[model samples]
Target: MSNRTGLARVLDDLGTTLIDLVRGDPARAGGIGGVVIDDPHDDQVLPPRALVLGVGVREPADVRARLDELGVLGAAGLVVRGPVVLTDEVAAAADRSGVALLGLAPGASWTQLAALLRSLLAEGEVTDSETLGGTPAGDLFALANAVASLISAPVTIEDRSSRVLAFSGRQEQADASRVQTILGRQVPARYSQLLEARGVFRRLYRSDQPVYIADLPDDDGGVCLPRVAVAVRAGDEVLGSIWAAVRAPLPADRELAFCDAAKLVALHLMRQRAGADVERRLRADLVSTAVEGGAGAAEAVRRLGLTDQECVVLVLALADSHVDDPAEHARLLAERQQVADAFAMHLTAVHPRAAAALVGDVAYAILPTESEDRALRIATDFRTRIGDRVVVGVGPVADGLTLARSKAGADLALRVLRAGRSQRAVARVSDVHSEGLLLELADLIAERGDTLTGPVARLIDYDLRHNGNLVETLSAWLDAFGDVAAASAAVFVHPNTFRYRLRRLAEVGELDLTDPDARFAAMLQLRLWRPV
Candidate 1:
């Protein structure tokens, strides 16, 4: 329920737990716009009031130089690894630059710090201004802290899978296990196994009362603190749990209050879930409209916060979504949603303005960049990370109003990949343009109910009636550009045999293979036709 914002809010939440103020006043920086890692090798556009993580920066002089540089860029704060040496020059630089300086705690990684800051910032991004019990809707950290104050202990809010969602401050006061959980953002597997063996989770979930556990033996043979846990439930559905590290069992009155807190927690959890669903649907609608490109497209793009920026469109689709079993189809559908969510998170982390949404069976991403090569690299990395279950198609970069053309290109490339015509799992439109064109041609012919004509049709008919290999031989020859040796090798036949079949096909179908125009027409037909 703290009304702190920007640098002050970050300090209030994470200070002394994962970071400490090294020098300068945090209040000097008004509001933090975004979190960005400082990479000296690559140029970056620092959003206004950015909090830059000075990873690998240790020297006092380097810190001062970065502070000065960030000052001109209007950055809010700079965080470097501890123990930071407080020098007069660094202090003076911070004072002159009007930027706050902080240090990440020892044993805490730069990655962990960045994640914590971003999570805190994302909570503020929720458009809802509603509050539950004076706590902002979905503000789990504030709720966790409030619960900690009531219980007189540090606590963690965890999802059903035992993954830590949010944690209260004073975590250092807790045991080593609790600190480990906070650091890793999940209950360790060994601890979960021990609890499962004890039937603790089963008992906790079976009842609405608080479950208490005595001290447990740690991996180092040391005794850990006791804990009290209560499930957060909405009706009969268990949403998550709130666990408090305590020295002794809670009294009856406090236990009643703890149970009451679970009810409030349930409301917040449900609100959070519903808000996420609504946000996703809204984003999908905006992306769908923007990519369709019409009078409404400009407004949709602006609403998505992508106005006036060059962007590359990417389409992602499952390589194989078909299954005979109903249950298996449901599983695939759930997996698609999971992949889309992951993709959206990944793109957002890369660029704050990046947008991704599940539109129909395909997930479309609008990356705010002017380089198709960079877009291809991002797609390739995602494809590799997700394994071979998905394929991504990258389109040419386009401005906001022209996004439809980019989306069309991406759709064409994705269609080619999904058709199993290409060996690649990720491709740009330029890389698979020919294959995409053939697919378009197939679609056109199918729509028009066009049947095969000319020599190629005759060859297909002759092969079907006579059980001959003439069509295959002609396809191979055209694919190899009339190279008899290569075509024969490709079809696993002797050059002489291949030549005999080719000549027979030309004679029987009345095809003038020697003529360039005839060769082109036959090749085009073969490219468009798929044999039954």
Candidate 2:
């Protein structure tokens, strides 16, 4: 029994509808050690988790001012009378403080509500009251197991991305869905698909109450037992969900206890998030250095705990064609982080040194392998697992010394995929054809005007001026590898007409058609120097 209580749990116990609305994140609201009754004359500050000030003594404005003065020492949330009208200023203060602003029932006694909270807190202080710090991951799992025991049901804790963080000991009555979800450490895609269609997530994010789902049918034609879930939130953001499957509905007491469990989960999740942030910072430095490549890069790699080995850098871009509104950017970023974490997790199973992170909208992975075949297989497997919307670009293999080159190759592959302007799941540097390479090279040298010179330009200029097909003819002939009959057929013309066009084209362009090198150069220029 963790002593931690979240603002959401308090609201759940009190019943949200009994209280009037204000602004704040419920997920960040809880973890209260004790309640403080604010006194205007008394100048004292309580640390984190203090839900300071009961109703009556302080007006909402006074409370807001007190909270502003408290600053970092402000309460986990503020309580008020239901009939008290809240102002925009108070609401704005709550938002800035990251504390929940809640109101009790219209006629509810503030002292009585404060006493109820004290009782609840006293009830929650278990013999095994866990403290923060140390190893948060281990503590989190232990807490999950305790929650399951308390509720007499199996419990699974998950992150915002629905990836399982921990699970309680399996009960004898555990259902197939529970077993499968535990085994995978994530909800099965098929089950997730079904739940998404049913608006389970939509309801989870919107409500503090336990969302109850009835009779979830499995693919094997078996129905799962009813499940109840509560979102583990931090402020307004949902950290994840805590779920329990049971044959019967959880009693009122048990439901309240479950909400208490959500607070403990939130505590553990906050710690985990802190740890991940540190890791991301470290990984970001390593990734930036590895991609950019400079002096002492090997030292940086070693610092990142990476070994010198052949590797391929993969770049994955999410499909965001319909993202028109600026508000959608944050959602896209969150989604990108989830996708990056998922990709990193999956890559780890395949290669020990594989690491992934999203630098903006693109998810990049540095995999410890040079094999193109392996890279392709990994890309295909990721696409199948992640979704078709993710487009993967695989770079050519390079050692630590040439990682910058690999990064460039990956970028080029992604560019080619984008330029193709078609639906493609994966693009590899190796998969790029000569024409694509020519086009890229042409773009690279376009400023210098070296590639698109002399004969090629002359032929292009003549065709544009006369509306003739000399350039097309030469291109077709070159593409056909000097096969006159094939070139003529490709251009939808007779061989005699193609021969005459070829002669005219060569004479006007001042070039020879016989030299293979010359023909290859001409073909390269033709593919690249498209008319403006």
Candidate 3:
């Protein structure tokens, strides 16, 4: 791959010399120094510091076939001598196969070709390390390839809204543009979700750490089913990510290696991004400073031509992702790079809190460049893909002083979604309920048996005896016992015997059976208890 390695070039030059030595005759010496053979399907033999010579002596077809068979062998060179003629196509093939060509005069000895090669190749040698140059990473194309090679993880470098900046391996595995097309066309809601999730991507970028999640192929929209994800980042800068959706999953070592690769990629990207940042920093910084209400600094920023309000500076985070080991964040993200690229556009807009993705199934993006319209689009769009399932919320935009508060509202909305299965996938700040009767009821259930064990005592005992078969037992008991026959039928005994069982009812019923609170508490405990 280096310019200094001219051995291949030399081989071509050697072919011409040999051909001239033979006087275009095939009868005297079978080509001694060069001949060509090609076999795409077969791996020809190659020896270290060796030469190959092929000789063709038959009719044109036979000569070509023979040349092809032997020329591909990595030989010092090939030679041919015979009663034959060479054509343009035949000569080209010989060069492509690395065969040096030689032809002896009709009555000449083939020894002449052998002597010729010995003199030319005896001086070949390797260049020293000092003469080598550094690898170039001056442009995006080189950087992308270098990143791909370094991380060995499927990853995509993205902008704030998770828009694809650069990525590798997608061409052969998946077409990212096709996905964007589908998102832009068939499912606009999902596309918006990805944009909202951009916040999540930014977090990984700024922190230069990996973000991990599960089953979010298009973090902006697609539901790949729950699977692990890892995203990598650098201080306020995002490099890329690596992901795997293996049905059986990857082993620990491979996962760790992925994290390491992500870190390496982050370092590389940071170096490049810093250079770019320097080139654009003055304009960006002035605008960003003025946007946060620094009117006094307006003069400095005005030169960049960006008005204060138009400048939006945001710290984005990838939420709704969970990683088993926080330490492996970088590696995990690198492994999932391909997936990240696929959904970069939408992930950029997610609220941050929902970013705890790897645990169960929630990913949040922080929308930095606030707007009511953009927020609404993200919410509605997110709903369509993650389904009416899961809560996707957008916080009202706020100036820097209260930006965190906006996210807090979105977090509350997500909480409402988690509390029950009936909530819509996308929610607005107005719909969130932090304090309500249902929440109180939920609170009571959430308290576990610590405060209300008496109510669940009998239910608990029943479960203990049946290997936790509460549903079946409840169904059977209600059918067999009726309102007043309860304890008697459960034991297959007479009514008086059941009255004795009823003695504990008042104490157990202290939870107020008539209250939805009590009913919910009872239901919750029964559902979660798994006694072995």
Candidate 4:
């Protein structure tokens, strides 16, 4: 793989298909630290050598102003929607800031552009230093470009579901629908429906021979360019397909080359899938070792690229839904993996050194920051974005060796939330310390097989035998702090009736309501027996 890392590499890979260089010099740009979408509504910290996406900025004046701002922040490049007019003012701004200006292809969505850039940037972060067939392992973009070169046409690598995994440059040579497909990263429903209606996929997957598709009519009373597709296979299983937009049918030699490329693509796809699984397992092991803290913890932390800094641990788990059906359980497991991947990506965007991995049912993250408050905000924001199905527990900031302590605190906080003891979906240890302690006490009692023996226990026994509301009455009265009227309202009874029940329970249990110690004992027993 090429050692290119920033604007130069981005242009080399995605130039004609997704982006175009408009001004400044790619050579001047340094390595890209991160990719960030510029949000005018909020104040966002930009990492050094940042690539800023100007999603909505269009006019020359606005573009110029954004260039100047990004330059001050030491951003390496600015990307705006294209057909960009290279006016003198815009050129001057780019030169003054020493920031490369690129134009995003028209008809491509900002979401698509951001995803492409992030994936491209992530390739530079891989430490494996392994290659397959002269290209970096799992480098689908490079594979796609290679296939395109062999066929003498633009190409796309697509999965079984017809989702575009990678596309070569010169996508402009294809029809408008091809551009739309590349932009959305999937074949549009209309196009796929048409293909299905024609039995194109069935024919393509049925044989090793290339299936040639003639021009198809579009919704705009036009026709798409012809295409030749071949299914990629590993032994008997069909992995995906390679699609090429050609102006005419290929001659015999090119057809042979196209088939050979599919075989190569199959090897790459299998390697990519295997590599991802191995990487995930390795990360999980590293995260487990670091969070457990001990002899090997410091080394594990360093391997995760988090060392010599105060960091907080965040543990996230799905709220219990008590799912029992086998199909639902499988779906739930898949969803957990998806959420973990998203969490890892989100943390990476926040801080390049942040590490996250799914360990069992929970996702653990090591965020390199000392401020628990900032960690809380980040957790809260993530929870809000992911919805109420998930909960996050943030731990105190700790040094490398003490990360185990932070992990413990986070686990306890997560347990409290999972037990339904707190209404919050995101909380720090301090916010739920009392509840966590109560849960631990309950666990101790359960472990020892201890039964209730206090006044509250007697009240419970009497209620079961006589069908009385004594325990409820006492509980409400104690909860109200001896306010008879409030306690009566709480249980929806008259004050006199509530008072009578309370006094009757006291006599039956031989309890003294006036003594502070007695009250404390009764309250503690009630909480342990039935937590609120």
Error of 3 at 470 (Å): 6.9
Output the lDDT of residue 420, model 2: 62
What TM-score would candidate 4 get against the native? 0.93
Best by TM-score: 1
User: What tens-digit string does per-residue lDDT give for candidate 1 at 243-325?
Assistant: 99999999998898899999999998998889889989999999999988988999999999889999999999889978899
Which stretches of candidate 2 lie above 4 Å from their native place?
1-138, 148-165, 173-231, 237-259, 316-342, 370-373, 380-397, 409-418, 421-440, 449-453, 507-521
TM-scores of all predicted structures: 0.94, 0.56, 0.29, 0.93
Q: On residues 1-532, what C-alpha lDDT tens digit does candidate 2 reach at each position?
A: 2433566655544443334446677776547856777655643335457776554634877768755754577567777666656688887777777767776655445555565565446435433433553223425556776788788998888776777666666533677677666545568888788889999999988988889888789767989888889999888878899988887889999999998778777877776567558778778667767777897678766765465788888988875524867889778777788888888866754654677777867877888876877887888898898776677888888886677888888887776776663356687876775535765786778666664678889988898889989988888888888899999999899999999999999999998988877887787666666654
lDDT, residue 111, candidate 1:
77
Q: Compose the digit string of candidate 4's lDDT tens values, residues 203-223.
A: 999999899998798668878
Ranking by TM-score: 1, 4, 2, 3
Candidate 4 — number of clashing residue pairs?
A: 0
- Candidate 2: TM-score? 0.56
Better of 3 and 4 by lDDT: 4
Task: Quote the positional error of residue 463 for candidate 1 in Å.
Answer: 1.4
